[model samples]
Target: MHDPERFGAAGPAAPTAVAAGCTSTPRRLHHHDQQAYVWSRVHVNPSPSGVPGEAAQSLVPPPRSGAASVVVQDKLYVFGGYGGGTGRLDDFYAFDFRTCSWEEVQVLSEEKPGCRENNGVVVLSARDQSIILFGGYNGHRWLNDLWKFDIATQRWICLEESSPDMVNAMVNEEDETNAAGMGMPQQVVNASTTSQRPSCRFGYVSVVYDNKLVLWGGFDGQRWLNDMYVYDFGSSLWSQVQQCGTLPSIRSCPASAAEGKYLYIQGGYDGLERKEDFFVCSLDTYTWTQMPNLGRTPSPRYFHSCVMHSNKLFMYGGYSGSQRLGDMFAYDFETNHWSEVDCSSGDSPGGRSSLIAQVHENNLYIFAGYNGQTVLNDMYKCRLRPIGIPSPSLLNDFRRLINDPETADVCFLVEGREVHAHKAILAARSQYFRAMLFNGHMRESSDNSPVEIRDVSHPVFCKVLEYLYTDTVCDATLEVGIHLMVASELFMLDRLKSICEDLIRGEISTENVINILVASHQHNALGLKEIALDFILQHLSDAKIQGGLTELKSEPDLLIEILKLSSLQPVTPFARRLGNATQHQVLSPGTEQQPSQAQQVRLFNAHPAPQEQQPLWRVDWR
Candidate 1:
């Protein structure tokens, strides 16, 4: 839940208004003492040396709003926007996450789009690596031009131009403020056009899906629109979509995101009112379904920035009409719930609107926007973390019940030592125990006398009993792990056997690698055997000092494996770079000694190329 005291100026008030070329002094929201923060601002290094870990600062893009930006290959490419005194801008800049630095993208083409703001932009295709632009305000009139910018070529190509009839209609308008109240040179599109493209407009939401641009809802100079359109990139055609179901009301500047087959729309102004209602549209069915106003609903707002990450929809600061809101909220698709993200910690991007927010990897970035007082040049970042309480672990509960005399319905006599155990737990955990205690004609099942286990030692049996109860083994050395692996195989507990194999593999050293290899081969621990072979191959010299070669020489089969593996290892550039020059050397008992044909057949009969298998526990056995 969110803290209400954090929102300043109390109850709803009249919406604030401001003029161009001047700052509107909107006060910052009050800070609260939150338990945990979900958002943290990234402090970039601004030093001339570009050294990291200095005092936190940013060398970023200039302050601007209504910019068109898109992320490609870990780089954020920002295009034109209104840069205050610089008026409308056509300059391009990119912020590289790898270097944590900004660079101006040099345009190679002479033909380019003029200075503009409030344009729609999206990545056309991953294969082509280009940005598609459409419809924006160029300070004087509304634009319906369609352009494409190739990131690799640093070139722009105009695909389509604005209809002259529509341009003339806005130019000859009587009331210049037709788009109304939100600023810029608003004009009504009183005259309709027979053009094959969408009419001149800006502030519409655009999403790329299936190589098509899906655009919905914006001001068309005359009135707020609720129409939907699809532009096919392959065919270069625009078509108005016939939508079904309860459609969203006419609105503009709503925070939106698209994932899979659905597009989500939330909170925007409808000319007369700001909305808090949320809606989703399916690209497949072309249907709009209003999402239930459940959980912690955000206040009515518009011009906010929204992004999708890890199946979550995140929204940041925006104007709530009455005041600018700094609060952030996330809607989870899996749970269908909304939760307020705590940003009270770190440097929060306090209360701003018209900001450009984008997500790359695990970080959410917000660039310049109007903070009421001024257009910000500063940039902020938040490292996204997983939300909700983790499911509780049952390890401790089961551990406490192990060998409890009160709950012991059965007992085991192993190596002349009494180990109390629950029959239900043992039977439920192991197939061997289930058959022995419940199904077979074993004397221990009929009588209440303890079952005699002569094969396993007492300590190994105790560890096995603990694993039956908790499905885990702890504080096990390499010796104990090998015994546990044998016990697991005997009881047919594949998961426990895999865990034991992992324990043995993790404790492998040049001194212990030969021992692990011997145990793995003896117990059919194939994955662990592969890891040991690779370890011995990588550190042959160190292992040889510990009688590693003597042990393998005694076992002719093991010696053949080492020689065959070493002979097969290719000395690639990567291997050479890692200084593994001896990867191709076949170190045998003697210089000329090699495995015979019968020994080669025996080695081939075993698992092929065990070194290729991963060291992790195999899921196939489970």
Candidate 2:
């Protein structure tokens, strides 16, 4: 492992970058030819104070848009962008995640790229330890320059000078290749045979993979672009990439993020209008496939920002056609579903576009954007929760089967309504259905007649079918939970019974504790019964006031158990009197003298007023 101290500098003003140290010994970041063993990936290093953006409030970058951002050595570096009325900015800034502070980068080299916005920036490799920048608008004109900023030397070297006739040269080459080749498009042939640089463009998407920069879709000064190009860092050559499958539309300022061998692009402006389409390009075959728009997709917008973290693409605020948007959405590649994020959980940055976002240690940090009214330099950080393999229903692809009459073979006539269900699914999920339907015991199983369910209501039976098919229930209530618990017991769905038991347990209180205890005992809900019994034992004083003594007395076994359990624990004076009086009437304790009904009334009348007390578990005898 390389020492983090190697990147640290001595001065206060100069950029002091460090590779946030880990608790354990650091491992090789990348596996080269000499590297033999693979190292386990570690979580992103958290701030020393354990609070992100706490120290970043005072020192922040000036408001701007279309800036380029790249994360290196646990630090985020942001370059030039349009600074609203301040014009374009060429200043560079770096935020140290470890220190939670922003520092202006002091360039040692006098020569550097001019002020620009919407540029492409990436880190080619850890060994190079440099930032690669290319192509942007420089206020005066479009630029096609390539510059490398060395982190160790703190200097910028111009690898390729700004080209004035870059577009014309590329056009001439394409024309010649087409004229020489047979009636086929020569773009694909020239892509392999000829080496050429892309014309000057802004708002293009660029990502680094296998040490090569993949550039696609941007706006040249004249028109919107929809071409793909690759820059090999090893050969230092540029080549056009011929793609297959449905191509993404010609657009600019689209949100793009790269993961593994796939590049995901979504929402951009196509000169005519903004688009909300989604597409993915395979880096291996250069194939583009449009993903179906599914579930809570963001509106058509451009100049948005996206970052890939833990197999999910998080897209944040952008410019709609009419105004700026502040919404956040996440797209799951595994399930092909989009979900809106709850931005109200934290300090939201509000509506903005062209912001620079980078993921560090599972936290997404966005900085500098145009919010329609003004450019903003405020930085907002929100920790990202990994979008796991959706819910079980989505994972198993069975949720759609619920209440789908077209595919259902059995219909249950429940409480004056017909509830459709599949016999195969019901039989497979519950033993009650298997015996009643397939064992030749019921007439409804062999015939087309609907099965009559008299005991269960329509809503309750529907919840049962939902669990039978999808393995879960939605929006269960206290009333429904008690009825569902009874239905679950009748249907022999233990998992469903447990789920209902848990639901009813959460609703346990003095008002319903005894009733719940009686229902649990009647329905054989052992878990709920134990919990309810404990509740009554703990709150014996208040439970007595809830007036379930008649129900408690009905279940003589339950009442005796409550009395026996209460005898071993510390009790309030009122509880001791009640238990003793009830025990005398119920058990008739071995001819021992016991308080009569009238005497018990006198005993209660003579006792002191009930004082506020803790629950049985928390009660202190001393």
lDDT tens digits by residue: candidate 2, 1-622? 1111211222112222233433345476332312211112222333334357553233456777889999998899999987766666788988887766666787998677778889879987778889988888755556667777899999887666555465432344444344223112112211222337777888899888888888998887777889998888777778888989999989888999888889999988877888899999999999999998899989998889999987888999987866778888988879999988877753577888888888888578877777766666766677676333333346256767777889888877887788888888888998899988888767656588888887777888888988987788889987788778888878999999899888977887776676677667876767767888888777776634324543333465664576678887787665676675555553455766645445544433444335532232111101
Question: Residue 336 of model 2: what lDDT?
Answer: 91
Worst 10 residues of 2 by lDDT: 2-11
- For model 2, what is the error of residue 481's alpha carbon versus the real structure, in angstroms, after optimal superposition? 38
Clashes of 2: 0
Backbone clashes for every candidate come to 1, 0
TM-score of each: 0.53, 0.51
Displacement of residue 161 (Cα, Å) in model 2 is 1.5
TM-score of 1: 0.53
Per-residue lDDT tens digits for candidate 1, residues 46-131, read: 42333475653434666677788899998889988867656667778887777666767878976677677777788987898889
The RMSD of every model to the true structure, in order and in angstroms, is: 24.5, 20.1
